[model samples]
Target: MAKRARPGMRRKAIVLRDIDPPGTLATNLFRAVYNPVVQAWASGAERIIAAYAATVSEMTTDAPADVRAEIDGAAEQINRLVLLLTPDLRRWALSVEGYVRGRWRGAVLSATGVDLQTVIGPEDARQTLANYVEWNANLVADVSAQAKQRIGNAVFSGLSQRKPAREVAKDIREAVSMSRARSVRIASHQLSSLSGELARERRREAGLEVFAWHHSRKAHPRQDHVVRDGKLYTENPALVGKKVDGIEVRAAPPADDRAGVKPFCGCRERAVMVFEFDD
Candidate 1:
């Protein structure tokens, strides 16, 4: 007689199998930013692979064959990405490291007007970068764990054959949907964190204002622009054109092409300029 495994147990096993790849999964575990590129670069490839596998597994649970095929494809993609990155990042890291030592170090110091002796020092910078890489690696691992848990829960939930089969499909779909949305949000937050650090470093080296342009062209009667203290304010035309003190207002080409400056919007119309006094 063939031994029978409970649906829940079988589903759980399948989920685990899909999540856990065979062999050493820690091939590219280092951070590319700090490590000698080749030594510490993860290429974000592992996360990508895991995400794809989770997605396909959730969608194809009803068809065991499809799930298995998807897993194979995901594995291949992961391997290919890692293979391509191994040599590329290694060479890049060496080149970048050499550049930093030969020219970038002096240029960065000179441009930022930061005294190497007064601040944390070059040795400290390297240490800080290393710490950052390790922190991110830990974060990735935690996220991966949570993702696997979600997949397991979904698979087990669907294993209840007592429920309508469509219900199971719906459960799988919802689980995959939530997983993808959450993953995107988490990745976005991480990227934002990194961007913030880079921005701070740039600001510390050279004090400057960073402004992003937002587009607003609904072309409604209620829409109007107003001038405030050296800036533009908007609400409705009825509230616009109010006189203000110590400010100059004029219009110029909307698309600014000054060296080092780029226009934020594609609108070819003229943009109002507002200048204000310190007082």
Candidate 2:
């Protein structure tokens, strides 16, 4: 006779659809909070880039020291811009926290019929906010670093190739322009990821039994996520904590090492409700 399946060993698949479908809640919330901050950052980044471009445009000779000094000076300006935007970034973070908290509470209630506030308590909310603050700080730091690297590369490459000042200026302009676009995309993606993570946490805390990875058809489907899409995993301590494709689905911060939730990734998580047991 075939061996019997262990208790909770065979997961019954459950499809947890996105609470806020793409371009609906995710896009709207992200734009509402992120647009103003990103616009400010873009404005500051452009000014810095323009200054660097002007310096390069005026360069009569490709002196490495002079080029390096100009690049360093530009990096300082970018750092200052990041500092100037800290208040706005903090506001954006708070907005995200509020949005995620509400969505998570609603999703848990809808899936399990349990009020998340009653089960998870205020401590969980505080922890969630703490995580958001850390995540936001890291994001701002990354933007600063990217700006420096991008500007530095433009200056170094143009000078190395001895490109004409006007051409170098053009390249810098293009780089800065691209950065603005990328910033918006990144902000949107991170908002989606944050929501997925918080919702999963709330569901787990509310004693849900299963969880599913919701793949984005709009995203370039990765084999890892594609294979796992819509499939369910038990929320038992052993299984939920187990790594699949280098991602612990129930991880507090949501695993970032994978393509689905990595920077600019648009994947979401769906909390699966199994009625076999009652909480």
Candidate 3:
């Protein structure tokens, strides 16, 4: 029997990458500073005010010079970085948290004996995967856009003498396209890691068989393409390329007790049945 992932223990491998980038200092520092404050606030907003006051008092003028300097340096770095990337970081972080706690962990638990809906919420498992894939695609778009903007700004910032407007525009455009392309590639790599983490979670779920399933964005499954053998292959054409043994891929209702999934799940429209390998 495969060992199950511990409850409340997040997937370690991909979570690090999904974290928001720091403006300065170590990235984890932000989480360190923010998590406690947030936890305090969540527990009791009134008491959190007193806790906040205590935290403020902890930073006294009599503190050692070395300690003060270290704190100042870290603060400055974070401030600078936040100014530069706050908008993007904020947007991405919201999505990342949902993917980890709700999407990723939820699925892992549902696959095992735990009822995710009862433990967390009904939407936890499916929402986790859905938001992960959706936000990942959005991250690609945002990165591409930011890369283009960066390249354009970089080119204009340069002191170029006697450069024609049209020529400069064309050059900047090409550079931006290349930059966005690179960003897409990098984001794709990150998403690939996320995919692997999801797969790992699926493997760790107990008494359930999980299969990777993709369906067409449109109503017609016939129109979709899948990556196989380092090439794009259509469903019809690839059916002849390889034979899957005793693996019947089809769409069907989940077992009645499956994490208490409702009959008319909103995700059902996009769902494809994946084989669960369970004892």
| TM per prediction | 0.32, 0.66, 0.30
Ranked candidates (TM-score, high to low): 2, 1, 3
Q: What TM-score would you give candidate 2 relative to the actual structure?
A: 0.66
The models' CA-based lDDT, in order, is 0.32, 0.56, 0.34
Q: In candidate 3, what are the lDDT values of residues 21-74, reduced to their tens digit?
A: 222311232233322222222233222223223333354543233333433343
TM-score-better candidate, 2 vs 3: 2
Off by over 4 Å in 2: 1-17, 21-70, 108-123, 235-260, 277-279
- Best-fitting candidate, measured by lDDT? 2
Residue-level lDDT tens digits of model 2 in 93-120 = 5555566666666754554454545544
Query: Candidate 3 — worst ten consecutive residues by lDDT sum?
Result: 264-273
Instruction: List candidate 3 segments past 4 Å from native.
Output: 1-94, 97-114, 117-165, 181-196, 202-245, 248-279
Q: Which candidate do you rate higher for lDDT, 1 or 3?
A: 3
For residues 1-279, write the lDDT of model 1, one tens digit per residue: 001222222211110000111111112222332122221112332333344345444655555444334434544443444444444333332332333333323433443333334432344235334444455454444444444445445434444333344454455445445544544444333333322233233323322222112222324311122111123222223324432242222222122231111211111111121122123
Screening candidate 1 with a backbone cut-off below 3 angstroms (N, C-alpha, C), the clashing residue pairs are 30-40, 31-40
RMSD of each: 22.8, 7.7, 18.6
Clashing pairs in 3: 23-81, 103-128, 112-206, 209-276, 209-277, 210-276
Cα error, residue 245 of model 1, in Å, equals 16
User: Which 10 consecutive positions of candidate 2 have the poorest summed lDDT?
Assistant: 1-10
The local lDDT score (0 to 100) that residue 158 gets in candidate 2 is 73
